[model samples]
Target: MSKVRIYTLAKELNLENARMLEILDGLGVSYKSVSSTIEEDTVELIKQIVAEEGTGSADGEAQAAAPAESQATQSQATQSQDAPEQQETPQAAQASATAVQTRDDVAPASKAEIPHRAPVVTIMGHVDHGKTSLLDYIRKTKVAAKEAGGITQHVGAFEAQTSKGKIVFIDTPGHEAFTTIRARGANVADIAIIVIAADDSLMPQTREAIAHAQAAKVPMIIAINKMDLPQANADKVKTDLTQLNLVPEEYGGDLIVVPVSARTGEGVEDLLEYISLNAELEDLRADPNGQFSGVVIEGKVDKQSGVLATVMVQEGTLHVGDFLVVGENYGKIKAMMDSAGGRIKEAGPSTPVQILGFSEVPTSGEKVSSAKNEHAARDLIASRASDRRDAEGAQVLRKLTLEDMMGPLTTVRTVNLILRADTQGSVEAIQGILARKESEDVKINVMLSGIGAPTEGDVLLASTAEATILCFSVTAPGSVTKIADNKGVDIKSFRIIYELIDEVDRLMKGNVEPVFEEKYLGRAEVRMVIKHPRFGNIAGSYVTDGSLKRNAKAKVTRGKETVYEGTLVGLKRLKDDVREVQTGYECGINLDWDGAEIGDIIEASEMVEVEVA
Candidate 1:
């Protein structure tokens, strides 16, 4: 009879090689390793043993489950029906209560008296900075080629066994979503490595990683990558990092800086050694017998598995078949795989594993834990869903009220603003003019002034400082307005410079009303560009949609980027002059700006003043 390898047989049995090897040893079968071949007779005997032990299958009929969408719908219905007591509370209250209860169940097990486990390291940095290359060297795999847009699109977890011990790495993708992923990675990480390219060193994304790491309060190591390049400068990197508060150990700071080449694998061993040493000092621990709980590092819906999550166990061991509440979803862990893609029955503390069998993909960083029972898990998750709804409502309704403005009435009055303008000249001019408005009783502080539409970043800064946004000759987009609304951020737009100043002056006396906001009217695509001596640029275009009226403010766009933003000087149809152009009709457009090009898009819009609220 032909022989089968232990690993090949383990895959058929959905068992890890270690477990299969242990079973073989118990059977008194002689084997060299997992690579050793076993006779067909031995395989039959193992199957018989597993069957008799009732671990193989059931004596009943097997029924195919409903499709994924139908099953998800059924689960939602079941959850609603199961939580009657929660229905009595208001939606916001119910959501808040559920969120609290769910969080309590999902919180990682306490570290006290926990057992020691492998350190989980998160690699973070700017794009094209060798973060993935270093991971490739360590794992002996080239995975970057498979990534979309040549960037890691999702957080990946894997483990490597070395002479010292096993190390876990959570490779985070480099994208704008890094804001969330990097933060989550650091939260569950014992150590974070900031990969700085030796040549182009610090970039904007690098600063973002630094801020995330510092906010998470995790130990950070510096990896000076690309030492093989001609422009590589280790001293320059060290100096730059020192200025950014990542002081090197040699420079009397706590950070460990290692110069390495991810391509040639130079200095990698030293980096590993330092990480292991740092892990020793930190003495990270997990309770093997504690309730299995962790956080979702990253999650996505899979057509095959339905919902998949890359989870990192913090305190206890997570095993297949345990009922779990992951974020706002509840399910039994149907299967678990180690970082190596080997099927593992259980995951211990600090172990990152790919989990299957969730009804819905959980949010990254959401608490994941084993509940007392299916009912308990469902209830906890349902509550969390409710709490999230309540939280979102509370955030939206928590706008500044008249009663909250008592500070301006009694104490030293202060109005913090983030100013944005259409031009640098306008920004400078506004800054100079606003500086004159500063008074002892009512000081006006422009916290973060810039030149452009009010952005989400401005909203975040405004939220942080409890400030309002003021912009001139620039309109906030619908998307920006939506975010600002969600954050309860107030954005006031003005056309004339004096109008902006007048509103602020009115605010000192606590009198304010709804301000003007732009409403987009139509869009036209230029098919022909003509120049004239009197008119700067004449654009022959067709109205793509809506109606473009004469003298309406228009924005010219090249591809997806906006190029020129100004009002139309005139509108004409062939030889006759017209007031507007409607859909499916072509017209000649005259603007004060030059350099109008074919294939350019022009969008017309108007500003309408309304009540403040």
Candidate 2:
């Protein structure tokens, strides 16, 4: 007969290896280790012993059952049928109440103290900066190759086991379009690993990642990637990071910096070790037997599987058949799968698992709590809806603009906007201008901002949020416009900075007439540049479409990205300076900035006042 491994037999019996070994020792059976092999007869003996013990325990529980205890459990089950609000009290109160409850009680043994689980780390950085690459190396999966254009468009949660300990990583998209997704990652993570490319140093997305982590108030660890490249400069990256208040520990700052090469798996072990150490210091703990709670990482509706939501267990264990109340939606867990896509009966804290049972897709970051049953779940959802209505009723109705608030009693009106620009700098500049327009009566709420033309997804989001889409130097395609129109979403495009600001100003004033517009003047393409001794780097270019004039408002573009938007400081032809250079003519242009590069396009336009009927 073939010998069976002790660990394999333990798994078949649904027992821990350690517990199996203890049973063997108690039965006077010899064993070497979990990997040691045993005769078939020995396996049978172990199984028999376990079965006998389980049966004995069951018999004892039956004998110990009393009429009074049974009545008490029945009474508690009746109390649970009351309004869900009474059951959703503070965590401490629930824990204390559950501590005395028996298995016969209607509620599961939640609130029981659980051991420390793995730390969840959020990986965030700039696009093409190796955020996914690092996670791919750690997880030994080719997730980057599977992504469209090698850019992660959605949030992904993965679990990896290192020599030090196990860690759960939230791989947030590095592109600026997924700001909300990245923020959700940071909000639920125990730590944030801000991945910065060594060659690129710092980019706009990197700054945004850092800001999100800071806003979440989580400890951050810097991983300087691409260290294998010859042009990689880790020191320069560190120096730039200090400007953002992220001083490295070596430089007397609290931040920890690790130089890593995702291509070669260099410094990866050190990074994992640092994460383990940090998690130890934080003393992360949860009660697997405590009240079940989780956060919705992401959710989607699958045709075959129904509604699937990736939930990270925050407090207790989530089990199959457990009733869950997520936001205003509730469902019983029909099935559960771990990060590895394997079916799991239960998941503990820090474990990311996809659960099937939600009636509808719950928004990301919604709190997930276990319910007693389907009836309780429905009650919870209805109660939450009622509370929301009551809260709205208590607040004064918001007016459209400041002019509508003429009485002594007034309420602030919120104007929600979705901003899309051609570049990150344009988004920042427009946001700065909008910030100055906010007052007590008019509050500006930017729902989302990104760099690119608006897409169908943007339209759907605006439709759900009831927000206006503002495009700055970017336009929506015909298909996107059609969707926006069908969804009844307003889309506004602007070519000049002041024109956009002026429209927003009017919107806040309850009067949007006499709209300010920009007149299209000319456009110039930089053919070459000369480093003049006095003017720094001058862009010598030909007028591609229109004319360039001195003191005319100009915007520089590199490919599809806007580099700068300001007035042209100087425009000259050969030696003498000229006021305007028309199409087919070459001119040397001097701008306030020196970032002019070859193939950059300089667009000239002036803000003009106009009226639209």
> What's the TM-score of each model vs. the native?
0.51, 0.50
The list of candidate 1 runs beyond 4 A from truth reads: 1-112, 141-155, 175-178, 181-186, 385-613
What is residue 315's positional error in candidate 2, in angstroms?
A: 0.8
Give candidate 1's TM-score. 0.51
Q: Model 2: what TM-score?
A: 0.50
The CA lDDT of each predicted structure is 0.76, 0.78
Q: What does candidate 1's lDDT look like per residue over 118-209, in tens digits? A: 99888888889999999989877322223343422233687766655888887664422333443333257778888999998877567656
- Candidate 2, residue 273: the lDDT equals 70
Q: For residues 16-100, write the lDDT of model 2, one tens digit per residue.
A: 5667878878878774445456788888888899899889999888877786698999888888887556765588787877776
